[model samples]
Target: MKEFRMAIINLTSSIDRCHNRLDDLDSRLKKIEQRDLEDQPNISGLVATIDHLKSELNVRDQELLANDVEITGISETKEENPHHIVIAVATKLGLTLEDRNIVSVKRVGTTRGYIEGELRPRPRPLVLRLVRRSQRDDLLRAARVRRHLSTVDMGLPGDTTRFYLNERLTYSNRQLFFKTREASARLKWKFSWTRDGKIFVRREHGAASHRIRNEADLQKIFGINEVGAKE
Candidate 1:
């Protein structure tokens, strides 16, 4: 609970600062535009501040995104609870579970069937869907790459796939190019391309969009819709 509070406080502060800085820059730009042929002073310092603020804002946003993802994942694991999970899903619509609707909560670890001699978890029916495999070799290669510290193809014995900062990995019939940026003297990060040609990353599987060099070269490699999340 304390950690959650801290996260909220940090996120609020970051957003306030980001907005204040951005509003300041926009106001300055508007004044400059409205002025007669006067040469504007070097707003380099202001520009630098905006850049720094944006980076900070991006970090906070990514941290919040990761936190939300974690909370959602943990909430899903609650399906193991012996308590009844009320799934009030609307017809033709998908809904995520939240803490408010959960009830009859009892801690569970092993199979819960033996507890009540007949209590069983509700079954969820899955609708199967088929997707055609890509025929192109390069496209296939682009879609199967994994972004772990290292990867292995179980199909091949004694063969492991290895990747460094600049290695490209494929996933779900799409190519995910892995690249790194120097965050600090001792730290660097791996980023993957988004489906919309954006450079969004999450800390777990993605971090946040650095949007530096990746945006410039993304189109050349994947075109407009190539590297984005699949529809």
Candidate 2:
């Protein structure tokens, strides 16, 4: 009878220890979960801070490129003078530009390697920067009058080649512009264009256009959540 009583006490003690261990584990798990929940807001705040910095950086880039323009379809030679080309283009556009009006002009990429007995011509785009914003604006306005400009007008060898003139945007802005155009096309928007380093999209025909300054504006217009519209 004494042994039976002792056995009962041992079993009860074992059961109590098991229960205590389970309780301690539960408490530890709850703490871990609480810590994770507490850290979420901090992570979100850091992400928001990063996004704001990117936007500000983009704005600064736009300001820096305010007097820059990009020209495509201009044939390039091994020893091409970009300044002379810029002068020719200005003269073709019927604009008188003083030497001081142009800050610098250069091709944006490397020339293609030459191949023997090959007739194909590869040309790189020209990025031109003017001393004054007004000169850049005047050039853009003149180029806009004609949907496309012919290289022949600039007195280049090939009269058959035509070129396009556009604003010189930063890499990120270029990506954003491309995405905006794709989205607008998919949604059947009436018009889309860029002006003064800003992207604009018109949802309806004859309606006022809205400027899209960042990804958030695109999300609102497209009616998508954060993850879906991840830029």
Compare the candidates by TM-score and give the number of the best one.
Answer: 2
Backbone clash pairs in model 1 (N, Cα, C under 3 Å; residues 3+ apart or in different chains), count: 14
If scored against the real structure, what TM-score would every candidate get? 0.21, 0.77
All candidates: CA RMSD in angstroms? 24.9, 5.7
lDDT of 2 by residue, 62-177 (tens): 99999999988877776677887888888878888766888888888666765678465567889999998888999999998966677775656543577878889988889888
Residue 45, model 2: lDDT of 97
CA displacement after TM-score superposition, residue 19 of candidate 1 (Å): 48
Clashes of each: 14, 0
lDDT of 1 by residue, 10-92 (tens): 99999999999999999999887867334434466667788678656654544332211100101223334322221221100
Worst 10 residues of 1 by lDDT: 66-75
The C-alpha lDDT values of all candidates are 0.34, 0.83
